[model samples]
Target: MSRRGLLRTLGTGAATTLAAACGVPAAYVAPSDRSRSDLSATDKRLTWANWPLYIDTDDEDESRRPTLDAFEKRTGIEVTYTEEINDNDEFFGKVSPSLMNHQETGRDLMVISDWMCARFVRLGWVQEMDRSRQPNVTRYLDPQLRSPAFDPGRGYTVPWQSGITGIAYNRRTVGREIRHVSDLWADDLKGRVTLLSGLDEAFALLMQGNGVDITKWTADDFHTVCEQVEKLVRTDHIRRFTGNDYIKDLSSGDVLACQAYSGDVIQLQADDPDIEFVVPEEGAELWSESLMIPNLARHKANAETLVDYYYEPSVAAELAAWVNYVCPVPAAQDILASAKDEETAALAEDPLIFPDTAMRKRLAIARDITAKERTEFAKRWNAIAGL
Candidate 1:
């Protein structure tokens, strides 16, 4: 499924299950019990679970992933890569039973959104990584993403890819530049705008529009945006709420402007020059789908090695050239700029992929909605979104 299609399926039922899992005391694993004897020295293999189409793939042969193939050849650690994670809540439902019962999840490493990573950190479902084994991550990981509120100093998670939740518009169709989140509400855009429907995906950018520091926004800040959205929906100003389908709306000129992911807009711009993505003046949310090691992962040391290897600028550049999200390794910009292929070198200049200094100033990582806030907030946001 497309990333947006997977995200669109995140319904209330899955969210309810996530909220319920938070309160069960047995679900919390103590630090002392989080690791098993490392078999990495002899096992020579590891498994990884991630979302579909998230990594660099050979253009002619989709089954062959270049960077991953190189990793196995260099390190002799055969990787069992599965694109099994479609939705955060759904994946949590699949794995939570074993994690809470103190059993191996049969996977060594997995990538999930940082918001969900926060939940795992709180519940102690993942093991802390040994950074001594990951020096490249220690040096090259982007400074902006280094210290998220949920995993301060990042003891448990390493960002796989980072992106912005910002405004996207068809410059020709909209007939103006969208410089702020509030720009979507202009009279000319009435009935031509769409917002994301999922609560976790939608709220941070809206909160940023109100000039709230999303890193520490309050309940009132959330409700204030809710009220505004309700008004827009009531008046038919918003054409509809959307998932990844917003890409289609913007591309077809059916919708002039909407909330969109930075990475998706990159693909859109490749096909339609008029499509533009903006990190609004008020600010935009910087989020990541991160890699984490689950408790009892037998190949813990090998998994950590794989994580660090990607942090190398050359390998990171190869992956960044294909995926085109914001590269978490800033040094990779230089690598891309010097590539033999001009088209590959041009990726170095795409601000959406490697944000310029000015754009970097306007990005902030939003504090995730807490377990205590999840149930109530999802109920309200889902109602307004008509989910």
Candidate 2:
């Protein structure tokens, strides 16, 4: 099936309502009669689920992650880390059956994007974290990410790493400056740009252009923005909607500009220095791929320890340097600043990594679509895409 079809299929009111009830409708699991592991005492093992290529692995031997290995050696807490998450919805579909049934998901902790995390928080599929055990998180996490609309005060979700949804353009090909979201729809750029296909990825900047405060956006505001997007579509102002494939289009000069994630833009920049990414004048969405403990995990305590371990400045810096995404721990910026390699040291100044105050104001955390809204909007969006 096309990506649009798949998204519409999973984004139904029933699925969203179910998701709101179970914390992750896509990964909903029926409760298993089988008993959970009794690790209330000295449970030494933890099962962590995350996306592929998220963690640093041995350069030659991919089997090992140095930081995780260190944690095991120092604390004797064995981690069963699995990169089972690919697409958010795909992974959700894989695990939803277990969540709905109130059963053990066979994994302890998982990482998912913040927008989806909101749904999980709403459904109560994840457990509230013990803040006492995560003192480093309290100290080092960026103030901006601490109290998102999804989990106020971050009682349940802890951002693993954050990134920006911004504009990326090929300087060598475009031969013009593109500084704002409005610039994307200029006449000359008509067929040379792409927007993110997913609603969560594309909505914030579009809404920001209208000067709406995203944190408190109303349904009328959403529809108003949709009407504007529909106009853009009718005018052929938008070239196409895309997944990560926008990277390829930009590289080939098929697309001169497009909506892009900061992490992916960094990779493109490394390959072709002429590729430039900007967090547009209207502002961009600052998002995270976060960590949460599942409802019936046997190793919740061990999982908490692992989560805290990553929040340490040094550990966060190491991960941030490798992932090339925004680090949630601001203290890590200092650590990166002192790096021996000039390349790594210069990362400390990258606004996308540690957004300065000016950039921070431009960034907003847009609310995730409510269950009814998801069904309503998804239908409209899918119809436009001919899904």
Candidate 3:
């Protein structure tokens, strides 16, 4: 349910196959051809596709989503929410044809990792949102996330939820603190440390540890990390590369340290205080799975309304409490801090939820890996990870 770590396991093999099928065309959609009819005046409904257990569901009813319900009451717009996006690559294969051929993808709006959003943006497969209509989004969205390399000016995408990729370890078992990414390779941790298996998942932190600027990391910087990891793999210094399975290892005390996600580590700490997540002194990646309105969506304005509604601090705080990812609306931190319950109030201060200024200064949104970089980089990375 930690959709934060859900990006990498979307299966590179499936994405590669999809890439072949979706050969980029010479033609592209023009600005004039992007907009469809303004159906918001007549159609009171729109369909949304998202990952499972992503939204906050009613504890008692299990079927109702309170934040979404409130949106309907406020605007009279009905949403047909579907949890159909289990994997990014698989979902791309399903919808790419429709998008590329200028057909309706049967989804008015959707969410996908920022790395993949780069592809859609480059392809002109999605429509730009009207900034004038999204006052809440324009006001409350994190400034750090406003102009990612893919969506400059953020005219196309809005973060659905945000999270950090950093180091997590069982401090009690490790018997020392891990303050830097280099600490994972310390002699005492040999054959007991795990890195993520996916190339996109694993690279940024390693690169950051070496002082490479992830916002504009060069190919030489990438190769430097690869060389170091390859040496570790050969010496058996790394126990193995893994996905979210690292959670079980850290919880069971089978592995003392591993690459981890902030959101997942927060949940783990509730049950096991020994598990600690850290943003290494060097840096960490600030990532978001964003909301994008796909091309030719009939209910474009309606979808924009829903997107902006979530940005209101009170609504964002409600969602953040349930989903437990880093809230995109930093204003929500104050809202959660003033909660009536002590437990809810503590979340406001949790560095993992609302990262402090120090942590914020160290985090960077990595530039999207390009189409040309994908094939060769993945080939080498997968070989080293033995995936």
The model with the greatest lDDT is 1
Runs off by more than 4 Å, candidate 1: 1-26
Q: Model 3, range 151-262, lDDT digits (tens) per residue?
A: 9988999999988999999989899899999999999999999998877778999999999889999889989999999999999999999878888788887799999989
Candidate 1 C-alpha lDDT tens digits along 66-145 = 99999999999999999888678778888888998999999999999999999999989999999999999999999999
RMSD of each: 2.0, 4.7, 1.9
What is the full ranking by TM-score, best candidate first? Answer: 1, 3, 2
* Model 1 TM-score relative to the real fold: 0.96
List the candidate numbers ranked by lDDT, top first: 1, 3, 2
Clashes of each: 0, 18, 0
Output the better candidate (1/2) by TM-score: 1
Model 2 is weakest, by summed lDDT over 10 consecutive residues, at 1-10
As for candidate 3, its clashing pairs are none
Error of 1 at 78 (Å): 0.6
Predicted structure 3: lDDT = 0.88
Q: Cα deviation in Å at residue 264, candidate 2?
A: 0.7
lDDT of model 3, residue 326? 88
lDDT of 2 by residue, 1-387 (tens): 222223334444433443354344344333342235559367788899987778877888889898899999988988888866656666666766776677778888999888778877776678878888889988888898899877889998999988899899987777888887788888888877788777778877778777778788887887887787778788888888877778778888889899888888887788899999888787788888899988888988888888999999999888888878888999999999999999989999987788888888888787788866787777676555544
